[model samples]
Target: MELMTFESPVNAVLSGQEAPERSLKRRVPMTARTKQLSDKEMDALERQIPDLAQIATKTAYARALLVSDSVLRVDSGDLVRISLDGSKTVVAKAEPRRKVKVGEVITVRRIEDQTAGGRA
Candidate 1:
C-alpha cells in the first residue's frame, strides 16, 4: 500500500511532535484585560454614550470632508446632508418608517454632485 505525502494518519505518527506537558506549562494567565463592570456600575458610562456618539460622528464627518464625500442621515423624518464644517442641508422628505418585510429591496438613487464634480 502506498502512503500519501500529506495528511496521512500513518505519516503523522512518523513525524516529530511536541510534548503536551511542556506546552501546557508555558501558558500564563492574562492580566492586562480590564475587569468586567456590573450593570449598575456601567450605568454611568452608558449615560455618556450619546456624547461619545456625537463626537465620533463629528470626527467621521471631518475625515469624509477631506475626500469631498457627503454624509447622509435621516433626522426628524427628513433626509439631511452633513458637510465637513458641520452644516446640515435638508435633502428631501425621508421614506416613512415601516416594518421590514421579507426580501424587501431598498433602492438608493445616485445623482451627480455638481459642486464637487463627482459621481453621487
Candidate 2:
C-alpha cells in the first residue's frame, strides 16, 4: 500500500512551480475602522492638549485620539474618572494588584454598568 499527500496551490507557487488550474478566490483589501483627523481638526485638538501634539503626529496615536469617546485622568492606586455631559463617571476602580501615578491619561471601556451592581 502507498500513501498519497496533497499540497495547496500556494505551496506549489512557493516551490517555484505553477499552480494547477483551479478557481481562485478574489481578494479584497480591508478598510480601517478609524480614519485620520484632518489637519485643521488635529490642530484644534493639539491646542487643547499641547502635550499630545508630539504623539498626534504618529499615525497610530493620531487615529486613537480621533476615535476615543473620552480620555480620563488616572488617580493614585489606578483609579480613573471621566467627565461627560457635566457628570462625572468612574471608568476604572482602584486595583490592589497595580499602582498608577496621579495625572496619567488612561483609556477604558465599560465592561458592565455600575448601577447594575457589577452584574453582566
Candidate 3:
C-alpha cells in the first residue's frame, strides 16, 4: 500500500474571515444586536494602548514598592535594587550581548562589556 498526498491550491476555507467569540452551538434570537466599529477603530485603539500600558506598569511598580519596600530594575546594563527611601544599590552587572561586529577594523574597537570580572 502507498500513501497519497493532495496539493491544496486554496490556503484556507476561512482565510480572511473573523471567528465568533461565543460558541457556534449557542442559541440566539433573530433580533440580537451586534456592534460594528468604524474603519479607524483599530487606529484609535493603537494610539491609546501604550499610554494605558505605561500607567498600569507604573501603578503596579508603585504598589509593589509600597508593599515590599524595594524593587529591582535594569539600568545602564546593570541590575539596580531601589528602595522606598530614595536609595539605590547595584545588585549585579548585566553585560551587553557580545557579537562579532561586522566590517573591517579601521579603528581600535573598544570592548563595550559593562559586567565586572571579565578578561580585558
Candidate 4:
C-alpha cells in the first residue's frame, strides 16, 4: 500500500466566509472612574506635614563696618573714629607704619583666623 498527501482547498470554508458548527465567543467590556476631593479634605491632608520650627530659624554674626572714601593720614598712636552702617562708630587703633595716607581710598578688611587653641 502507498500513502497519499493532498493540499486543503482555498475557498470560503478555510477563510471562515461560511457558517461553522459552533459560534465564536465575545470579549468582556471594561470601565474606569476618577473622584475629586473637597478643599477641606485637601487641607486635612496638608496638615499631615511636620512643622520644622528650629530648621527655619538661623543665627548670624554681626558684619564688619566699612571705612569712608577718605583715608586717615595719621602718624603712629593717632586714634581714628570711623562711621559704620548702623549709625555706629569704630575706633581703629592706628599704627605708625600703616601704608594708607590721608585723603586716599580706604577699605576696611577684617579677617578672623582660628588659633591652635581652638578659640575663634
Which ranges in model 1 have alpha carbons more than 4 Å from their true place? 1-31, 69-99, 112-115
TM-score to native of every candidate shown: 0.46, 0.24, 0.49, 0.15
What is each predicted model's overall lDDT from 0 to 1?
Answer: 0.61, 0.49, 0.59, 0.37
Residue runs of model 2 more than 4 Å from their true location after superposition = 1-65, 83-88, 98-110, 114-120
Tell me, by lDDT, which candidate is best. Answer: 1
The total number of steric clashes, by the backbone 3 Å criterion, in model 4 comes to 1
Across 1-120, the per-residue lDDT of candidate 3 in tens digits comes to 333333221211123222333223334455655778776996898899999888767766766566567777888999787787969888779767656677846454545584223422
lDDT of 4: 0.37
Number of the candidate with higher lDDT, 2 or 3: 3
* Stronger candidate by lDDT (1 vs 2): 1
TM-score of 2: 0.24
lDDT string, candidate 4, 6-54, tens digits = 3222222333332343234333334434558799998887776544333
**Pick by TM-score: which candidate is best?**
3
Model 3: residue 39 alpha-carbon error in angstroms: 1.9
Instruction: Encode model 1's per-residue lDDT on 30-91: one tens digit a residue.
Output: 44557899998899899999998887666555545555656778989898887757788887
- Cα distance off (Å), candidate 4, residue 106: 35
